[model samples]
Target: MCRLALKTANEPFSPYEVLQAMEAMKEGYDGSGLGLLLRGMEFEDFKYNPRFPILSGIAHSRKAEQRMDEYMDDRGYELKYDHRFAMNPEKMSGKMRYRYFLRAYRMPPAFKDRPQEEREEEMLRTRLDLRRIGEENNGDLTVFSFYPDVAMIKEVGWPMEIGEALCLWDGQIKSRVCMAQGRQNTNYGINLYACHPFFIQGIATMTNGENTAFVPIRDWLLGKNIPGYIGYQSDSEVFAHILHYTLRQLKLPLQAYKHIITPLSSRELETHPQGDFLRGLREVCRRLIIDGPNAVIGTLPDETCMLVMDQKKMRPATVGGRDGAWAIASELCGVDAMVPDRDPAFDFQPMREHTVIIPPDRKELQIWSQHDQLPLPQAA
Candidate 1:
């Protein structure tokens, strides 16, 4: 599968640009599916109602649409803005079963003054309830993401073709950080839910290789008894969940993710300063250790974008950009397409021992080493 992520330090960029990057790496994907996750959005409605949570997905029928409206109304959610993409029937098969939607809703009256944590909990419950309803009704309605400043769209088609079908090139929903994946159907049977760039809470991730250790990782996540840890349609979904679990649930730093997923060997740990802590964490998170060939690209809540590789480092990945924009992709060609004028000397491929992390500020491109707590040389 091909994966690409773009993050602008200041100005919001179009998700179409990310699709362009993925399109450049067409050799790595078979065009089975395309998934896009846009965060820190700049839509007109969002600018006015920046605090409202956006519920994005597809409604398969008029009945499904009505059901969603009724459900939200019953829950006291005020519909602030309802924007539906006018899909091109000719571009997106005439028989397409669903219409894309990005609806922003004001919170229930009672949640208006509630703590942020409490409000977030209720939103998660609402999203899960809607998801369950969709599943029960044969996917009459499907919600990909329900959070503030985030929106997702996915379908089965070539990355750029799907973008055109969704009318994303119109540039209505631009974002500071956007991630797109051109999927190569392997074992998932071409399900939309199985598409990459999976998200949970505010964290999102897309992967390029198989997760041979998916079953155990999924089991461990489910065993955590988290409210939103139910979907396992894609093996790579676990990566996003793991990120949420590590950062939100476990309250660990972002750097700890590389350590948790690909911990240092015993001999290497021996020479490390936090060897004891690393040892304990390795044991505790053994099941979460990713096995098999894989490369991950993800974005945190703060719009910090990161790229990490499995211990084997089998998949191709690269990071490149200038002062205001940076991008990570599964291949050098993808990065080249995103930022063609970037200095080749600054563009680097992260190894199994490092994580390429670019904060929202875009002031520095940090290459963090898994073997040490300190950061390696950074882009100037």
Candidate 2:
């Protein structure tokens, strides 16, 4: 199992803070890599830019940078501003470490006034094509995320060291919501691409346990016409894919995702008041059911964030914080690292077969069990 921690708030918070939280649970992971996805950014130049795709990625060599520019222009993307990472790490030596590059682009003017859905599809498709191009060419590049306000940084190193080297406390970078992971090499060899906190479009996810159900899930996603579902370096990446397929492709709600991956038996489903309604959902998405010891936390496209565990509850997770900010972690100490003085009296563990949902704007955390997840009908 790896260490997973996600911190989200109404105001911008540093990813390094979450990295420190992952460090607090260092006993669980060896720290082969660190991955961070930040949303609702406050970067000085990027924060004020008009609506456009802001791409953040890793370029292994000089050739990779040139390759990216050519590919983007060839694909009808106009380069707006290419802002290089500004970091001068004193503790580390040798060629500025890994450069986290950000480039803002204007969609071809022709795409203007198109249905919102078409624009989203094209953005995701082009990003996927770029990743494939980068990987096949002599240059090795992985564009972590390509949404308007989201920025991601991933690398091969200790989480705390990477965080400190990047200077997360610095004012230049920050986000209102961040999904972060510290990789502990277990089932596969270490590769920066295999790191956690996988992102697709606006959806991002990190898991603390293995996904035994990954193969079937992968196969199902591949069946779709989707192009971005190419890499599966880490089995947990499928969890992020599952979220994308359910919401983006199938057009379901976030709670429906928890139902897809962690469904209850028919008899158990009947216990909920909306068993009849849930039955329809179960029948349609049964193939998406997961079989494993896993706990997942993620942000949906709508900004509604969630934390859930498999029916077995083999994984450990704790949720704690006050209104306006919340932290989810594989262990209690991880949460403590983010919100130091959070009311201990207010903290609680999400039981097996349940999910904790924090609405897009509200600070309160709500629960939806495997039984009856839908809101109750209003009084007549």
Candidate 3:
């Protein structure tokens, strides 16, 4: 079931009123309801623009340039200069340049009997301004000579929605934790709607394996097994289930605090079919849950796990302690850095010691191939 909340410009048109209007439209058109409703509302005055937000200012600039070039090409006019509309001598060699110079420079000799060269130079200068105006207004059929609004849409409007959607969709993955943190001040606020089950499952399947764990979560909500307490059962309930499952898999023992620490980080999400980080995290979590907390060893095949040193607890030699103690973080840098040194006890090793795996699908490869493990070919 779909539950929609509408925010209208006026208070009198409540969300329920919008829903009723939608229902009426649906009744009027039968199966073609949504399309008919949209058609009816297409010309209505709405606060929000119906168009999808533009994503790149460069795209707009490129499109404008293409249109201008096409217009010039159709008119048999060669674009021989920069955006400012000045003629380029390089593009027009000896004969072409001379012809163009004659056309541009030749003027009535009655004004002043100037030398051919000097008159040509003066005429060229006079035509430069007019040529600039013509170039600037090329391909423009509207009363407004240039699409300044298009430029503004590209420069300011496009990136806003696109970036917001990106940040929202990407920030919830467990592996993208660092990147998501970096985007917290900007489009991250849209994480509310972006962290839905559809997005989560999409991220999970992005790496190496099918998102089997998320399937159950989806089933629990929409497959006639939903709990009565869930007032509005929808995709959001699936999100809650997956969040709970992730926390449980992580072995975070606090049931009361489930709400506080359920959502996985964007870093942990495996969107690519062969993303090692996603696969590794999933495997680690699966192993931990299956074999109990002590089964961290031998779970990650061909991978060296790092034991994070808890700075707050000030523990020096322990492998596991806090919630995120066993998880791998960035490598230690300075001599005085708090992170533990790579040792056999902690199962930590540099990339040089490990054999990297490359999945058959090229798109699943990580940005950095540090975690890739080459799979052996199956027997025929």
Give the winner by TM-score: 1
Best by lDDT: 1
Each candidate: what lDDT?
A: 0.83, 0.78, 0.21
Residue-wise C-alpha lDDT for candidate 2, range 58-140, written one tens digit per residue = 88777777888888888788887776555647644323434578777888777877877777778888878778887797547
lDDT of 2 at 283: 85
Clashing pairs in 1: none
> Which residues of candidate 3, in runs, are more than 4 Å off?
1-208, 213-216, 223-240, 245-344, 348-380
Candidate scoring better on lDDT of 1 and 2: 1
RMSD of 2: 2.7
lDDT tens digits by residue: candidate 3, 190-233: 32122211111111100101122343445443454422212221
lDDT of 3 at 365: 14
TM-score of each: 0.95, 0.92, 0.17
Tell me the alpha-carbon RMSD of every candidate: 3.4, 2.7, 28.2
In Å, residue 226's CA in model 3 sits off its true spot by 8.6
Per-residue alpha-carbon lDDT of candidate 1 for residues 3-35, written as tens digits (9 for 90 to 100): 555545468878888888887788888878888
